[model samples]
Target: MRLIRGMAGAVLLAGTGLAVHPAHAQQPGFHRHDVLQHDLSVPGREVVQVRVDFDPGAVSVKHSHPGEEIAYVLEGTLEYEIEGKPPVTLQAGQGLFIPAGANHVARNVGKGKASELATYVVRKGRPIFVVAD
Candidate 1:
């Protein structure tokens, strides 16, 4: 179907570089799905939503968002760490917000795959995510 093909292309593009870092290759079973993107009613703003899946023991490198980010766990458990705060474990039905420009990392700490829905309110034409040293 057309929709399936489009989704597959989006996923491939997102994984190629739009949302993933080269270092991500070291993390097995990590996948990012570009769910939707739309220009916000507010000028110069856009809302992008993605579904991120992390297999057991997978971890992401530190990164920052170009704008505010909100994430909700859909399944399993995620260990999230943001600069200046202690890491927190979020289970299904829980969510967290990350202020713009804050460095953060996420890891799958559960026995199964962890999935989360992430929404970002970002500046138009800017990369939604940036790798942080």
Candidate 2:
């Protein structure tokens, strides 16, 4: 199981290009809603679930998670890039996993809005996300 916290920031690039920027980049047409959160049986561990929605052309700035992240696409297409890896296109019913502390970005490459369900398993008392430098 995974969990999420709060809004940190996002980087909005024009397309598939990768450009580093400050955390306060232009706002993208993206939204995140908390689905569930609870403490794990393991001490100092927690799980969070969230639904992320992206309008066409929306892009998230480079960032890292406090723990492991797993995402499943529900609608449209998404271009997901992790540091040192090629961008992968995920469509409906597809899923991906990201390890803790790996910089990554996500964009809505399809013509319409895209949505995904993300789960996080992280240490308690830590922010769910951190903006990468």
Candidate 3:
């Protein structure tokens, strides 16, 4: 049902990361689902992928990840506000990169539900979702 290979290659080109603050991990109609996990050739490194869905008008609040993330839009539009950088808005089939430890918020800017394929290259055994403000 899946192809595990090449995920690391995707991560190599994917460095942007984003997360939802703990308080809003389950905000109304907002959801995150782990898609898969694969161990990287680098010792103590791993790749984790998740599918995050946002309802219209839903906002992630400021948050961060334990490592780099490459968020590719799967549907709808999302606006990303990352610390120290201008806010970026992405549409379906587009993507945005968020650096590790960067505080950011991902909001559903479209009238319909928005979602992303958030893939991360992170340290083994570390939580991908980290608290942020």
Candidate 4:
């Protein structure tokens, strides 16, 4: 139920291209939202631009990725915990990269909402996520 609402909200925001991030006006050709995406047109390779809007006290479900993930925080602060890795905090303007198969989850521990832009290089014809703990 939570996933559905979260995804729906994300979809709506993405479609409307709302205030995706404080820096949205600076980057051209990019969509804005709580979670917006702009796919990079790389032939034979998948490169997608993703934005994550995080509300205070919100934590995402634990999940694992099948591809390499790179992210940059555009606003607010995010707290991340990955399997076997010490938790880290990413403030606005920070970045991170997760290797393939790494289990991880993120939470917005800041006072306000947060946002991030991520890119993934995934295998073709397969989904990218698998729930994990």
Candidate 5:
């Protein structure tokens, strides 16, 4: 629990402006579990954010990260793919980091819903660098 709180504080200090309430801190709700969260905003530098969600089949598009990303599989499985590497299968309680300029994608590869959390430290105004080519 202390680790989760520390992570949450780091996220808040790294943001430009985010409206979060203590009442909703670390609780499971609709769409996401939100075990913790942090915004990524650095003045004249980079932006960093962390998101924790609880659900199955939640996914993002195939894209690249302009900066670096660290993702932790808190409670479920996820199918992860990078542009030039063999796809990776992440199970519950696992985590991986994607380096800057690396193209990748992720999806819930499990049969049912899965929950996971991700923290990204990225260049400001640029997050996912998706190319259709």
Candidate 6:
């Protein structure tokens, strides 16, 4: 019931001239809700925003984007591990920056549900996300 409601806003880009089907592990406990997106002034660049919710113990597996991402914690604790960097656990109102092409993952380390607002400034015509090995 919650998963269905949470998934109602999961919008994926289609007309960006790229067919991006991220082969990410589909976890039922995790959901993504796209909030907004726009073409940046920079040619070939665009910005997108999404709200991600994580059930207790839910995990967003390793993945990478074409550009950069800013993540703000909105609810519970989330641990982010960006490649080549130490793992950081963020609480409500905290934030983290992820460099372009850096592989990363997020885990809900809190007892309750966790949510984060992620904004990405990424290259247009490229996959917003790619599953990482």
Clashing pairs in 3: 16-69, 16-97, 16-98, 17-98
> Taking the tens digit of each residue's C-alpha lDDT, what string does model 6 give over 1-133?
5444223212222222223443333446777675877889999999888788889998765777899999999999999999988999999999999999999889999999999998999998776866565
For candidate 1, give the lDDT of residue 113.
93
What are the per-residue Cα lDDT tens digits for candidate 1 across 5-84?
Answer: 33433332255344333323323467877688888999999888888888899877677788999999999999999999
Cα lDDT of model 2 by residue, 19-82, tens digit? 2222443355976665778889999988888788898998886788789999999999999999
Ranking by lDDT: 1, 6, 2, 3, 4, 5
Clashes of each: 0, 8, 4, 1, 4, 0
* Stronger candidate by lDDT (1 vs 2): 1
Q: Give the clashing residue pairs of candidate 6, or none.
A: none
Looking at candidate 1, the ten consecutive residues that score lowest on lDDT are 18-27
Q: State each model's C-alpha RMSD to the native.
A: 8.2, 8.7, 10.7, 7.8, 10.6, 6.8
1-133 per-residue lDDT for model 4 (tens digits): 7665444334323433333312212212223343333344665446545576776777766666667888788898888898899999999989999888898887888898888887767654444555563
lDDT (Cα, 0-100) at 80 in candidate 4:
86
The residue pairs found clashing in candidate 1 are none
TM-score of each: 0.81, 0.81, 0.78, 0.68, 0.58, 0.81
Per-residue lDDT of 98 in model 6: 95
Query: How far in Å is the alpha carbon of 66 misplaced in model 4?
Result: 1.1
